[model samples]
Target chain A: MAASSTGLRYPSNKKTIYDRNINRTKTSELSRAAFAYLFVEMITYAQRRVTGIADLEKRLNTQGYPLGLRLLDLLLARTASSATTSPANLRPTRILPLLQFIHTTLWRHLFGRPADALERSAANAAEYMISDNDPLVNGYVSVPKEISQLNCAAFVAGVIEGVCEGAGFATDGVSAHWAEGAGGGEDMWPGKTIFLIRFREEVMEREEILGRAG
Target chain B: MRREWEGEKLPRVVFTLLIVSKAGGLIYNREFHAGLSKQDTNELLIIAGTFHGVHAISQKLCPVPPAQPPPSNIPTMPVRPSGIEVMESANFRLQCFQTVTGTKFLLFTEPQQPNIDGIMRRIYELYCDFAMKNPFYTVEMPIRCEKFDRGLDGFVKATR
Candidate 1:
């Protein structure tokens, strides 16, 4: 076999990202216009060769999955660095803390704010929902009437799934649905989105066992 | 009124802007406020190539510490090389900001300009929206979008 020299070269002595601290760096704000533009292109790319709206949402979900996986570690590292508590103490063990992590830490890191609301399904203990008013990714996006049922926020749902899976909480699926003006007519957020998160049966069983142990 | 407005205004701070591709090609170059001497297109191209070479060499020259044993189980991201960040002369300051994807934005500003980082970031944001997001724009290609130019113009004007 011939020797190949086509790989990328990096400077020696560079420390890996893990060795460095995450808290020292300030949160940098990105340009909304740019993000909106990139998202439009992403949707356009995903729109190609897709069977229907569900397929498009699936593509977006897949695109965001890897990001969620990477962000889980990064967000955990940030929390560990910022808080006075030890890293082990900061780890979310049960469903509540895990949901709080996604609602506050993950949401803040991604969109500069916590999710609007977090609620569990009254009928189904395994189901939870995170609500967001005016999701950043959908700021300038206007879904056509032909695909009005489609919610591009499915990408964010995928990220949520990644975080849950990374934390060892197996889930059946995470999906985004439009729930605009559900509370009342005087509601402020007309484009409110509700992300439905359903955990696997085994996960709920494990939670029950852990709950009893605690 | 126009004459009075012109008289009250100060000169522009941003002089020139250049966008270099990941492979170090000069994808976009524009002079907002011309200097005393303007370089021709060929000269600008050469300058871009030379700067790219220098940036790469500088990264190589960075000193590395002795190797240590890897940690057992923690996932770590690879640290990127920090190349030439800023260059200053009596006339102007050259600032370079590289994105995560390795595309570089080089901005030339007045020597005493404040918030160069902010300006560079805004420009980057504009590039992401106007250049990278444009369906007509192919990756690593020259940027020639009307919206990008207009956004940049507005930003530069606001800065002044």
Candidate 2:
């Protein structure tokens, strides 16, 4: 094979992924079915040769990690290019903006609807929760009867971790948990998923300094 | 267009569908009408592979070269001529549309069916939503999305 100056080989079409614009299409919507099938496959792949539920969930999360990293750059470029909404040249320097960006912009992009709620943890200052009622992925997947503890949305959590890491916000870990009947919620909306995002000590410390600066 | 004052029916049937991956592997196959004779899965896979090869050769066999556009600063998508789009026989017809990403949709329909291209485009749309966007779908692998099946069922029913 003939090699280019850079190691990346262009396709027969003579176009590289770099030649294409990532943020070109905005109005197109993804079918929930696509996400559902993908989620099921991810679970199936992770379930193979697995020790326990936690290990399976961890594998699913790891699978989605790189997707989040790529989306972080793509989405930031999208927001910066589209000037109609709030200022175009915004990169999330602080924790609040980044969280808000994920809660609103990223959620809407992925799920077509904004997250149900975003709340700070009462007990842990570093922990934040973003909840979605009847997540699109969960809507179509009926978890098998055997492993009831598995939350397929852990893949989404992995994506959030990638975004946070890409955006320079280090986190202790991000995870997905079923918030069924917790905190006096989801009585009307069952299968509510709460994404628990916990920032590292350094992140909270930096937030402290940033808050003082403002 | 025929007058629809009777409120009877519109189009005909989509007998079957075969999806070939960019690499020419048979990724999906489904039968809609019960009457159409079925081919063995192995036979279908070979047909798909054969068609992929023929499609590639057909592009090279084009008698005339496409005229180059005036030089421009912006890079453009390569405008290669498409391969065999429609094949007609005394009994049924085969309609094919290949996506830019190289995934091919082969739709078999009744010979008299109209507006097959529109239906092909719609099928492509469904594939984009259900197959391409799927995170677990390794590119060029078999597509097994329940939503895609449901969507197709609904679409075919409504079309009929």
Candidate 3:
């Protein structure tokens, strides 16, 4: 009789992570109601302040800013790992590219699509508009009658603001609004948020000089 | 690329991650993979509920330290309870990880799921990385973090 080993042997043939292929069969999914209720509580939690809509929006934005900082790093790492492209190379070293990244890559990553449009106001060069058809954060939030002007996504706008500021842009303020344009619907879809990004006038002057010098 | 293993039929497995509060409320839930059986889902929820109760009781039952002496040499360490359990049924295994703050993560997967403890650690890592760090994420509330969910999905998919 042949002697047998007491310990059970495991799979000895192990492959590297890079050699692994996508398991398309196993996908991830989450419930929407859970998020809605959570966001509702967040809005209520922020409502305890003794101030106006702007103050409330400000509080919400402050809450989201730190997240933007962390996401900037994590997003770059994830994108860099999977694809051949280096995220650090594609990273925004200047202001315009950063804003473009926010409108395109960052928006797409978070909300499953890119922002609808990005345009610098013809009347005010300092002001740039970043529009989204449906902002995920503000999807279920219904601002109370007293705080009608408040768009709860001001929290996410704040995060974007924090990200921009962290990236070295001198930002005046980041605000979210509900638009009744041709793209505006019901509780969820009608939330056409326009993140009004106002860069400091000095920053624009620097951009112009940089453009001329380059 | 290894094309030989692509056609190989491995045992089907799935995972569902949930965060339950001390009061037995569902704080966060995400199906990290889709191949889980219905029995697994029900078992996972039950496991989550049961662990939530156990953790609460454990925290309360934790004994307080006796009054300390004024001895300058000895440092008084706080007494706390560790609420962690690995539960297994016939179909799947449930790993319950709890933090000192009373937050718990319930991870359900195949009974023979390997590196499952590592997955739980990474899930906790993502919680710290995304959820706790997220300004939008309120303390002890259900996580509404898109990044946390996405990151967990990406990690599980990548490893699988």
Point to the candidate with the largest lDDT.
1
Alpha carbon lDDT of each predicted model: 0.81, 0.80, 0.72
CAPRI band for model 3? incorrect
Q: Write the per-residue lDDT of candidate 2 for residues A22-112, one digit (tens) a residue.
A: 6756646766565566566667678789998899888978987898898888888887776665653577888878888889888888877
**Per-residue lDDT tens digits of candidate 3, residues A1-214?**
1234222342234444445453221242345556666666776788786387788888888888888887676666666666788644455766778888888777866666789889887888888888887787765444444556778888879888877777777789888887755432444455677898889888888888888889
iRMSD per prediction, in order: 6.7, 6.1, 10.3
Error of 2 at B102 (Å): 31
> Model 1: what TM-score?
0.54
Per-residue lDDT of candidate 1, residues A130-186 (tens digit): 999888876555564567788888999999999899888888879999995476722
TM-score of every candidate's chain A: 0.87, 0.86, 0.77
lDDT of 3: 0.72
**Predicted complex 1: CAPRI docking category:** incorrect
Q: Mark the regions of model 2 whose C-alpha exceeds 4 Å error after superposition.
A: A1-13, A84-88, B1-160
Candidate 2 accuracy as lDDT: 0.80
* lDDT of model 3 at position A84: 85
lDDT of 1 by residue, B1-160 (tens): 7744664453547899988888888999888887626988888778788888898898778656429746858766656787999999988999998888888889998776779999998999888766766544578988877657867998987888
Off by over 4 Å in 3: A1-30, A85-88, A180-189, B1-160
- Rate residue B55 of model 1 by lDDT: 89
Provide fnat values for all models in the order shown: 0.09, 0.06, 0.00
TM-score of 3: 0.48
